[model samples]
Target chain A: MTTNSSDFGPTNPPASMNSVGPPAGVPDSAAFRSAGPPARMPDPAVVPPTGQSAGPGAESEPAVSLQGVTKRYGDKYAIRDMNLKLPRGRVVGVLGPNGSGKSTMFRMLMGLSRPDVGEVKVLGRNPGWEANGSIAYLPDRARWYADHTVMRAFTWAQSLLPGFNLDSALRLAKFMNIDLDMRASAMSRGQEARLMLILCIARSVPLFLLDEPFSGIDVMSRERIIEGLIEHMSESERTVLISTHEIQEAESLFDTVVFLQDGGVVLAGDADELRAEYGSMYATMQKLYRG
Target chain B: MTTNDWQVEPARPPGMFWALIRHDIKLRRRRGVVLPRRWRMAYAIAAFVILMVSVTLEGPKAHFYLNAVWYFTFGYPFMTLGISAGRIKREWRNGTSGWWMSLSMPRWQLVLAKAISSFIRALMIYAGTYLAVSILGAYTLVLRGTFNAQTMGQFLLQGLEWNGLLVGAAPFMIAFGVLLAILSSSSARPLAPLMWVVIGGLWWGIFPIAGASNWFAVHGSGQSAAITITPAVFPAIFGSWVLASICLFLSIYLMRRFVDISQA
Candidate 1:
């Protein structure tokens, strides 16, 4: 995952283009270092000193921000010098292959793991603080208590998560054709996947992180889940980050795309802009990775 | 939908703690590892049967049964270690802990809830067995016309002392078990039986090293020595309680900072 500074030289561009590499006009020595949130975008929640309104150019803050964040396990870096910003009210696809640190990045954002050297902020606060209430996460694997029936699982969620909408969850469950009385352990892998999706969608959080949500499910179920997700996206001013290898299937759902390789972003931009410049997401991704 | 529809209220810490405690209790019961209803019933029946047999064999010697009960109660630490260890290991093996970590609750709260719930569950089981034995002992004393106020008072006092010792030892045992499960490989096979053996061997070794092997044998004697609550025992009781608190604190600290959900 280590690369010489020269390799990242010209590949980095200015933030105006939502470039994947370093921001423009910085010395090569500090190119990789995160220059904190752009000067134009002052945080709205941070009150200006007495009798002062924020500048007119102040832009809405990102839903998630990672600055010079590096998470290491033993001697190996899981996430190395990563800097990313995900804007609100958009569906961002985090495209990566296996062992590309997708899960590690997600864990850091969820506050399950801490960065060794940098800062991770979710919804304007440190990850795992009050930001937790604003994020709904569905992990790659089923994590429910196997002994619990679907109804019991819902009950547990309702009790713990303040934003969990029981009525919505029940409706979603019915739509998915899942029995509330069925034990979680008794469900097949595909059924379990659907159940998890239903649970995540039922939460009314501002940020949603779906990690490998479509993995191992049948094509038909995947389509249904995708449709459900799209419906949810349309109804709310929410941000979503879907990490997946099923890029082809999920590309259309994304408003933005981030391509990760060797624990660092190789490419990132608005999906429509990338489509205009590079034809299609699949083609763009293929060219980028194959290059 | 209104703008308020999307607003997510912050989760109250106490609500989260209670929810986790309820979830853990349900989990333990379903897994049948800690104070399952069926096991409770089975234990009650066994206790009754033991009382009946002991009464028939040795009339008016019901106090003898107290010795057996005390020894059995003393072994609760070993039981606590096995059950708590198994419960934690199962959570890791099944990935429930990862789910728990994903929730919008503080890490310390989760650990504290589990520890409190597990300790209470173990206490309930020990209390049930102790109560049954005490009832039988009192009935036999009444039958023998030896149930005087002074004798009854002494019996109650001894019961309280024994309970204090057992309670003092419980937290450390359960906390250590939880710590081991949290630290060990999730894929490792069940270590409950092996843990029991190891704990038993360690206790045996400690008895000889502490020069308390004779005292241990005397404590187990049913009829030879009368149980007493004396000033001499207060230091050991205080030390045991202090040790328990330290283990519990360590368990919660490690769980908050070091537990790796990715492994689960």
Candidate 2:
């Protein structure tokens, strides 16, 4: 099943590809130096911004742009006439309560959902097949193939996703303490979460849309996942839009944060600015969500 | 990829469509459409026991009973329909459906591969059923000193001619099943199976109008009557092919326009 000449077995991959890995025997993930994004990480396919970014240095083309986008499922609307722009090369956190259309918005950005009105542009073109290559998506409530062990999952991704970095994936798996031979069905929830994150971050793609990566995991696993994210962030500059309810710990990861409520943005700005104005991101979100 | 891995030419790697087909086949080899593996296994064992008991007691009459396996082909189209919808539904239900939309191939190719995998699995089951029954029946007839190759061959050929209509209808059934899975809302999903029957019934309605009764009058009068077919089969199969094409087109359209296949 090995796709490449690399030592990783079970999945076949193209040639050699490396991910950002910390030095061996690092006790604390927080201390792991992010040597800056892996050189192979491609520039996010961001379209020239027609809308303005509210963040600093907004003049550079934004990675994602949505204009009056409305998506309805039957009688109810998922995202209603929403407009926003996300800057490239920053970690953006999408925070919202349950049913705030966070998942729907991600689906639209991935070209998995159609908008009833308005437009969505990712990396300069509409999402779907055209934008698929440049984006790595981790859908909400998604699990790995139940039949697949970590080794098989590596092979599955390598065979299907051309840019899949098997070497980094293997290293990440080791760092996460994930057993390569364990089937997804047999793994704990935390193990599965770590495995899924490795798959997304190991890719050489620019934009990452992660929905609920931390949902229903233990505190320890959450820290490990955060560590994985930090590793990815330090390795290279990439546009990552992560939506999660585990806001307290992940709040610090965001350079920019968008608060979604009832399918539209209630508040959005630079994370540091929002913190200065309202104290912690958790407090700001609680105020916005309750109010 | 090196050429030495496959039985085909090693120079060129498998194209996306072929690669997808290979992956899809591997996916379905273990996962059943409707039932769990235990139930399916129990079913096969039960069928084997019934066949063995019937052959032991009834001798050549078991061949007469096994002739009913031809009627099982009529069940193939519906089985194909279920497998087709199940394939798409599993991806959505599991949250591993990113590959479905993210692949840089044409939407039509995805639809075609979905149908092909389901069709292959259902056909394998369908053909396997007939193969088992026919082989056992043949052996029984030989043991009874009544194995008439020409006579049995003619009967089998006649059954093929009649059952061939279901084979023609299979494509339409498979395509419609896929469309129904995507077109229907989650709340409306419970009704999908009944919808298939109604749609399938409407397709079957054409046979009666095309003079199925007349063929029955001429060739289906008795057990020993000559099973001649009316010339309506070509038009029937042709009409189904046309409808199947239309279904595939509609499926492609839905993917490009309104349906977010994962949610759908």
Candidate 3:
């Protein structure tokens, strides 16, 4: 449980995939992986069986919702029958190993990619050009505009996007100790990540999707990014769906956690409840991967 | 879950058409040739001197020398097809296509920005190259004691007609290039080159119907090739604009539903 590597390093191997339903503690929703063909079994405890998920002081609308969504590329399924409803004004950590369809889910939510089947709604509407105003989406594997200075990039963003605040962005950059005159192509990966986070954080939007903001970042930059994120999230009524493999570092920020494997939800619940049930978010991850 | 599944992106530029123009300007030096700033200036100067000297010659020799410059002025848009395609492809090449797509603008607006920017870039290159060439050619004619004010005056009108034709054809060239770029990055890539020829081949059809060589010259061919501007120039330009609009419409339509930035 103490080890933080992506690998679980199982102590007790669970039953084989063919002989078992989900390994001892995993929810029935994980049956998609065990049954060969996907079967959606939204656990009543984690997934809202119908309508929007309601959190403490939650409004009528969920920040984002996906209903029986399945996206395929050629012959392979990137996401298969995924049903997710994230509550408004909550920090939901999307935890999964590589190839767990995490980025695919974010892309679908941002309307960059449409599902082959089912529906996805972001900020109470179908994700599209019109729905873009209420959501600040940070894509996985994004690079800064190679030719722009941080100031120019900010100016471009402020002009084009409806909710971006130029003062906040400049202040955020200063707070992160970055030089605005630096060209985007010359930025260190950590500085670029922090700058990107600032862009998302400064947007006056209700929903924020941050996909893998910590990979390859240095310790100091990660700490600053987390602090900046915490500062912004605490001050606003923002709903954020963040996907990260750095579970231990990001675990404290999650109000709820969803663990995915092979494009299906294997374990999900309130972060504190999961901590009490399985020891910690890390421990729950271990159990989910015990198979 | 894999590397492909994670999108911890840097900030995307805004989706406004002007935003792309600003970005393109920043990268202008880096496009095409990889020369240092001083070397690029030197090359332009050298080309200018050569064109000036060439214009001073008499007979077929002057025509032979100036033909390259004329072709560059008129043929300039053809060279930009790859450039226009490359401009769109650069987003994918830099792996920022998804970020560009996520910006809150319509897909057509994105493609339109590129088309317009490419057109502007083509015009800038044409203006710079020919302006210097024409000025220097006139200067050389003066130095040779054969500078004719009347020929020089007629050249201005010829220049406008040339500009008009280019202005008309530019949309089709740039729009088709954008279409080629999107299609080249798509599942329909195998058919792109063939599609380019069939659709863009319509550009040549106008030349035959309107009479290609009569009214189009950038102060050329000593005397024989230096024809005055014709009334047909207006119809020719109008025809090119029609074809260009069709290409732009096709590009916007395809970009909305078919073009996948991630694949780029």
Best by TM-score: 3
Model 2 C-alpha lDDT per residue in residues B162-218, reported as the tens digit of each score:
455556677888888777766563344566687667787886885677674453334
Runs with alpha carbons beyond 4 Å of true place in candidate 1: A1-60, A276-279, B1-14, B27-66, B131-164, B183-226, B229-231
| Candidate 2 chain A weakest lDDT stretch, 10 residues | A37-46
lDDT (tens digit, per residue) of candidate 1 on B127-230? 88678667766766687777777656556656666776677667777776765665563323254356557657767875564354232223334443446445
Q: Which structure among the candidates has the greatest DockQ?
A: 3
How far residue A166's Cα lies from its native spot in candidate 3, in Å, is 1.7
TM-scores of the candidates, chain A only: 0.79, 0.79, 0.82
Q: Which stretches of candidate 3 lie over 4 Å from their true place?
A: A1-59, B1-68, B203-225
TM-score of each: 0.74, 0.77, 0.82
DockQ per model, Cα: 0.26, 0.26, 0.30
Q: Sort by lDDT, best first: what order?
A: 3, 2, 1
TM-score of 2: 0.77
lDDT of 3 by residue, B102-172 (tens): 87778777878887788888777767766765776566556545568775665555565566566667777
The models' CA-based lDDT, in order, is: 0.66, 0.67, 0.68
Query: Which CAPRI level is candidate 3?
Result: acceptable
